[model samples]
Target: VAVFTDVDCAYCRVLASHLGGYLADGIALQFIASPLSSRGTPTYMAAENVWCAVHPHKAFIKAYSGGVPAPAPRPCAVIVAHDSQVAHAMGLPGTPGLIGPHGAVLGGYLSPRDLLARLRMDAATEPSP
Candidate 1:
């Protein structure tokens, strides 16, 4: 379960808020943190800031939930660069995109129940090793 997300999207915030719910049920949710620079929404920059923060993942979740402004104006270009590479490799050009085990893209805002169902379906349909 790979979720590519941007910090500035309202839907992204909603999705993150449900991570715990999904995980509580034994779902392994991996993230790709895709930044949306083309939207001119400061998501990419904020992502860079979050990635550069001491607690990168936590800072991102907090900032995405509207807790505080970027930890600082400066950010690590390397971190942003790596994330960009990840986005390109994964063919993700927008925030709130998902790659389930079944090779399906789950995009847009989805409630936790919907997400759990999608993941379950994908997992059930996946070819076993």
Candidate 2:
């Protein structure tokens, strides 16, 4: 699953809290920054900070644990900004936008079990090739 998330989004935090459940259900998550804050704001910077860390995956996990790294390199801001831009371009209404493996829009912030069920249902409904 690819999730468009924000550092300051409570829903994103809830989704992060369910990381174990997602992984246990064989859902490999890809986090994409989609900050609700404008560029240069602390919240947006927080997303950039995660990208700046030597281990961004670890930093991203820590960020959802109520913390973010120090201010990021100016360069990293571009990547984070691009992530938000891409999410916006995709027309996602808000953070924690959930996209299923086969491009299904899984709505937002669903529990792992529910998400898997949705995925399975979608797969079942698809016409056989």
Candidate 3:
């Protein structure tokens, strides 16, 4: 699944906190940063920093879990801006939008168990190869 997430959104944090459960259910998450904080704000800066981090996934997990240590402003071009643009184009209502493996949009935050159930249902409905 691909999750359009924002670093500052509380529900996004909740989803991130249970990421392991999703993975345990064979749901691999591809996290795309959609910073709710407008450009030039500290929240946006943190998102940018996480994108530029040596270990971006770990940095993102840390940011949502508690806080990400501020890093020196680097010259790396972060993709969070583009991610936000894509989310807008997709007409996503909010952060933590989960796009299923078959491109079904499951908008909003869903508990890991619920999400796993949905994924299983979707898979079962798919035409067999």
TM-score of each: 0.77, 0.92, 0.89
Candidate 1's TM-score reads: 0.77
1-129 per-residue lDDT for model 3 (tens digits): 899987889999999999889888888999887887788898888888888787787788789988874573564544878888888888888898889888889878999899988888888899988
**Predictions in order: lDDT:** 0.72, 0.86, 0.83
Instruction: Residues 17-81, candidate 1: write the lDDT tens digits.
Output: 88788788766777665777742357666776677777777787778678764555555767666
- Check candidate 1 and list the clashing pairs: none
Q: What's the TM for model 2?
A: 0.92
- On TM-score, the candidate that comes out on top is 2
Residue 95, candidate 1: alpha-carbon lDDT: 68
Top candidate by lDDT:
2
Q: Which stretches of candidate 3 lie over 4 Å from their true place?
A: 127-129
After the best TM-score superposition of candidate 1, give how far the Cα of residue 72 lies from its true spot, in angstroms: 5.5
Cα error, candidate 3, residue 93 (Å): 1.0
Q: Residue 88 error for model 1, in Å?
A: 3.7
Q: Could you tell me which residue pairs clash in candidate 3?
A: none
The residue-level lDDT of candidate 1 at 58 comes to: 79
Q: Candidate 2 clashing pairs?
A: none
